[model samples]
Target: MHSKELLKGTLQMIILKLLADEGKMYGYEITQKVKELSDGQMVLTEGALYPTLHKLEAEGLLITEKVSMGKRIRKYYRLTETGQSSVLKKVDEFTDFISMMSRVLQIKPAL
Candidate 1:
């Protein structure tokens, strides 16, 4: 897995992009999906994940709903309307930033 320092800056954007693509997802499910999608190169720890999730919720970009499973309550998160709209801007900005950085570094754009 990459260092937290490497992942830290992009975590929120990553979460937003994932939630934007996948709709609602619970915390563990989000982590697992990330690991699966990244082929285990990025693992999100609860320490980092929960605070980001809480911050996004507090910021009104995300809303949480709790559902009781057989024995445990699971909190699922989805984008608010604002979040849904903001994600496109975030993704586009990040993409452009990456493109610019790649140009400076003389590396090919990943996508």
Candidate 2:
């Protein structure tokens, strides 16, 4: 698994992109999706996940709706119009960052 330090900087972008792709997702769903997509190499604990979600919601990049499942309520998050645009920008920026990092680290494509 990758270290938390590596994951820290990209967590917001990850969550935003996932919501943009999936339309809407609850907290646990987001965590599981990240783990699945990363082949279990990245795991998001509740401690790391919820605060980011709350911050996004506060920033007007995301909105949430609560639905009841049996005795519990699940909060589902989806991108706002601002978030939709932000996803495109963030993806482009992250792509550039990766390219720059590769150059700095002298990483080359495998055959």
Candidate 3:
């Protein structure tokens, strides 16, 4: 698994990108998706995930819907119009950062 220190900086971007791609997802689903995508290299505990979800919702970047499943309620989150635009910018910025880091570290792409 990646260090928490490393994952912390990128968590929001990861969440936003996942929501952007998957439409809407609940907390658990998000966690599982991240694990799946990373091939078990990254795991998001509830401690880290919920606060970020709440922050995104508070920022007007995400909106939620609640649905009843039997006796329980599940909240699903999706991006707002603002979030849709923001994710595009975030993805571009991160991509540029990765390229910059590779160049600085003298890492070459695999052929």
Question: What TM-score would every model get versus the actual structure?
Answer: 0.93, 0.97, 0.97
The alpha-carbon lDDT assigned to residue 55 of candidate 2 equals 98
* lDDT of predicted model 3: 0.96
Q: Please write out the lDDT profile of model 3 over residues 46-101, one tens digit for every residue.
A: 99999999999999999999999999999999999999999989989999999999
Best prediction by lDDT: 3
Which candidate would rank higher by TM-score, 1 or 2? 2
Provide the lDDT at 95 for model 3. Answer: 95
Q: Give the lDDT ranking, best first.
A: 3, 2, 1
Residue-wise C-alpha lDDT for candidate 2, range 9-106, written one tens digit per residue = 89999999999999999999999999999999999999999999999999999999999999999999999999999998999999999999999999
| Whole-model Cα lDDT of every candidate shown, in order | 0.93, 0.96, 0.96
Superior candidate under lDDT, 1 versus 2: 2
User: Candidate 3, clashing residue pairs?
Assistant: none
Error of 2 at 46 (Å): 0.5
RMSD of 2: 0.7
Error of 3 at 5 (Å): 1.6
Show model 2 residue runs off by greater than 4 Å.
none
lDDT of 1: 0.93
Could you tell me which 10 consecutive residues in candidate 1 have the lowest summed lDDT? Answer: 102-111
- Candidate 1 per-residue C-alpha lDDT over 1-111 given as tens digits, one digit per residue, 9 for 90 to 100: 688897888888989999999999999999999999999999999999999999999999999999999899999999999999989898899889988998899997468
